[model samples]
Target: MLLEGERDTILKTTSAVLAEHGARREKLIPLLQAVQEQLGYLPKLAMEEIAAALDIPAVEVFGPATFYNSFRLHPPGEHQFKVCMGTACYMIGGQIALDSFERRLQIKPGETTADRRFSLDQVACVGCCSLAPVVVVDNFVEGKVTPTRVDGLILSYESNGQKVEQDSQQTEATNTDEAKGEEGS
Candidate 1:
């Protein structure tokens, strides 16, 4: 059930996007992208509307949406946590860090918290190889993150705290110092 304004906006935008792309089978992916970008996630009503617009079956419309990793069926939470599982990070205990986040948050990857506060996901990499076991919290890259640090990070977001921001800076500095120590060793 969409709010009146939301229903109107989605209908208008989906129609405009469909009109711009036309009713071609080849244009399906682009059509889905446009609708998701405008609506945040694909609502059932919007999907049905898109199917009707494109003269395709509803299953045809849903098939690609579910197949693509980029599209989200539900709205995202306020905060998004993406853990990088690159080779360097994984060798340095990325899996453990991910497990820690899952255990602490009580939600597995690709799931949002029941309170709608946080969402967790595992990415192939955040491109911060130096920051092995990196976790991107709301777009801030945290390096050398351990299981203990994951707890503190979640707590910071709770109760209106900004420690996560402060902690990211400290973690970067700490990681740098640790790297120097390893080189000296």
Candidate 2:
């Protein structure tokens, strides 16, 4: 189901992308890519709009969308964790790392956290087979990640996230105060 405001944004953005590509069916791939780049994922409504703009069936849009591994149907979480399940990684306890994350985050692969803070996904390979039992957090690969290390990593992310939020709030308050002072002057 699409939220009203998000749906409107998706429709508008998709339309603009189609226009930029001259609304040509040959530009379908680029059209989809542009929409995904803007929205972080391909929302269903956006896909439908793209099909309509190209005068194609929604299934045609959906088929290619699903076929491309890079196109995500759902919005990505603020933090994405990709676990490598390659032969070396699996042999070296990558499964343990994945299980630890599932337990700690309380979400399985291809799912986001309840708080919408994190998402977990498993990849066939990260191309770093040498880094067996590797976990890539936000794009930084952590090699030889153990269950205990997972705990520390989660704690650090949570703590750092909180600190950043607090800092942002403080900065906003300071800015507001300065603005009020200037207005009074």
Candidate 3:
């Protein structure tokens, strides 16, 4: 929940937006978009506020928000994870990647962790076919991901934010460590 002042700010902005609608139903999209832009996701309270100010039904406000894929009814996770499930990705084990996440997260696709730290979702394609088994974690599209790679991905996100360069370095270090461990064994 937002603090009073923050909620006021959102309400002020959204109310002004709704005021300009002049009873046009189409205006709902942009109004919702504006409020969502201010807040990452639309709160139920915001819908009620909008309904009251606009003289519209709360159900009317919810319909468009629910219809749009970008509109998040609940607060989104801090880190977003998406796996490509396109034809190519599927043939190369996208389902397996999805399973890896379900097992680790204990949540199905389109759900978030209880801690609100990670959100999991699926997309038809990430547009990187060469990397058929692709997983995108916080906008870093990883290719040829194995199940173990999911753990590493989660680790990176759970840890302090790691940059792409840091990821490369860590991958190298991990490979080297694995080689050493194998040699020792």
Candidate 4:
């Protein structure tokens, strides 16, 4: 559900987009794209408004929205982590790396952190097979990812003035030691 302010913004943006696109049925995909480009995601109310403007059912708007992978119904967080689960990556501990991120961030794939700082996702492939077990952090591909490396990555981001939670401090220490061990091997 969107807050009052967010709902108002969505409505206004959707209205502007509709005005520009002229509510034509043939312009559905382009209109959706324009709205998403402005708002970052398509809100439910915006879709309904689009349906009404186009003289179509809400399901008509929703069908293509849900069908397209490029469309995101939920707003993304400030940071995005897209873990590749391609054949090569999966064979080389990609799932382990994803599990590590989930444990550290306390959020599963396709979900964003409560603070809206981070979002996690799993992609089928990124076409970087040579760099198997890859994790894409905010559009930068991180190759050769591992569970210990996941901890280090999170810590690197959290170290930017945000204090680590008390409970995670011990886990960080343990992970640091484990990273050292892995480096020596």
- Per-candidate alpha-carbon RMSD to the true structure: 6.5, 12.2, 3.0, 5.2
lDDT of each: 0.82, 0.81, 0.79, 0.85
In the range 1-185, model 1's lDDT, one tens digit per residue, is 35548778878888888888886778888888888888777766778887887788999989988888898776566788888898999999899999998998898887778776888888997788998989999868888899878876887687565757786566567768989999999
Model 3 stretches with alpha carbons more than 4 Å out: 1-6, 20-24, 106-108, 111-116, 175-185
How far off is residue 9 in model 3, in Å? 4.4
Off-target runs (Cα >4 Å) in candidate 2 are 1-5, 106-108, 124-130, 159-185
Error of 2 at 12 (Å): 2.2
lDDT per residue for candidate 3 within 1-185, as digits (tens), equals 45448667767766776676643666677777777877777877778887776688899888878888888776667888898999999999999999998898887776778778888888888799999898887768888877877777777767876854577569769989999999999
Q: List the residue pairs that clash in candidate 1.
A: none
Better of 3 and 4 by TM-score: 3
lDDT of 4 by residue, 34-105 (tens): 999999888889999999999999999999999998888777877788999999999999999999999999
Error of 3 at 72 (Å): 2.4
Of the candidates shown, which would achieve the greatest lDDT relative to the real structure?
4
What clash count goes with each model?
A: 0, 0, 0, 0
Q: What TM-score does prediction 2 earn?
A: 0.71
Which whole-number lDDT from 0 to 100 does residue 60 have in model 2? 95
- Pairwise TM-score winner, candidates 2 and 3: 3
The model with the greatest TM-score is: 3
